[model samples]
Target: MFQTSSALIRNVHSQVADRVGTSIVRGDIGVGETLPSEMQICQMMDVSRTVVREAIRTLTGKGLVESRPKSGTRVRPPQQWNQLDPDVLRWRLETSDMDSYLAKLFQLRCAVEPAAAALAAISAGQDDLTLIRTAYEGMAAAKVNEKFVAADIAFHQAIYFATRNEFFWPIAQMFDVTLRQSFTIAARGSHRARALVEHNAVLEAIATRNAEGAREATNVLLKNSADDLVRIRGREFASRPKA
Candidate 1:
């Protein structure tokens, strides 16, 4: 009974946080604006004060809100928010700013992935190479759209881990959400054969311990992806109704 009740409370807490976070991201609740009072929130949400308080804490931890002794809780500015937080990333993607978000995401990838790939080429052990090869094979064999994207993500993750740099792991894992979205967009107009060719180029470079080749291969892949997104975004914007 305790477990069930706890789960119910947690669900409500998450629901409240998600709604409020979405509102903040959408500008319904502007930064520096105080949220409803604890009592008012409890009443409006039809939950206890504890739930509202916990939800507020969750948002605070995500840098969405901050509490002050005299001012209550207020939404924080976008720059203050944790961009890597899963919930915050989801909120940003759900909003109309996905193009800008993707641009930033790709920029980040361009900054880190090529260097990581180069490191992997030099540092990967047999087991690490096996893992990367397995993921590459999965990508090569994936027949369905969803499977292909999942395999693509797995392939990149394997390379990140192969680098054997503890610091690289977390940074690479943080890209999970955005990477899926990116591959989805890329897959719309991308050919499976071309993707396999590019992926193979990177994998072969790493397997051969050619650091420069691995770096250049990853850079080329990212460049192609960015080009595809730019073309797609242009078409999408052109199709939108004039305001």
Candidate 2:
């Protein structure tokens, strides 16, 4: 979704929002704690008060902070945050505990993607199939981690579009950063060849209008991905001290 966005340069307001948002999510600015006043933030960030105010407004829209007339803006509780916002998700993934985040992300994928695959089998047009096939070919050919993850995200995004379901599109949109990181973690396994096999199964099933087969193939792909995550992290977990 953010593929064309600049990585090196951003607007002053977005830069401030990201900085403050990351701090809030990281608990560097605790819930209910008031942020510095507009003047203070302007001085601290070396931006105008207008920019600071706009940044605060953006954060407020994301449910990360709330502002009152006299009280200023304060960080909100975890439950109050818009957890599904891609920016919020990226901040949490950047600053919070990763194992917990990936586990939850996998659970969400398990719940959504198989159903999407089944729907795609029933609804995809030729163009959709072509897109999916192209992405799958990219995955099969990728020799580096970066290429693999990019191709992998494109492959799943193709499936979401193929489903032709409005609701599934938003769910797929949510996967951008989370999905890439998960695939990167899982890419080291010996499962890449098997992943290609599973991908082909889903692709072929959708191409043939085999809904059940498509769903089952997606399940197999996800299960193996989960297995890969655990296998890669197993050694690190094993070495952790018992509580």
Best by TM-score: 2
Clashing pairs in 1: none
What's the lDDT for all of these models? Answer: 0.82, 0.84
Q: TM-score each candidate.
A: 0.87, 0.89
Q: Compared to the true structure, candidate 1 yields what TM-score?
A: 0.87
Candidate whose lDDT is highest: 2
Q: Which residue pairs show backbone clashes in model 2?
A: none
How many angstroms is residue 102 displaced in model 2 relative to the true structure, after the best TM-score fit? 1.0
lDDT of 2: 0.84
163: Cα error in model 1, Å: 2.4
Name the runs in model 1 displaced over 4 angstroms.
1-10, 233-243
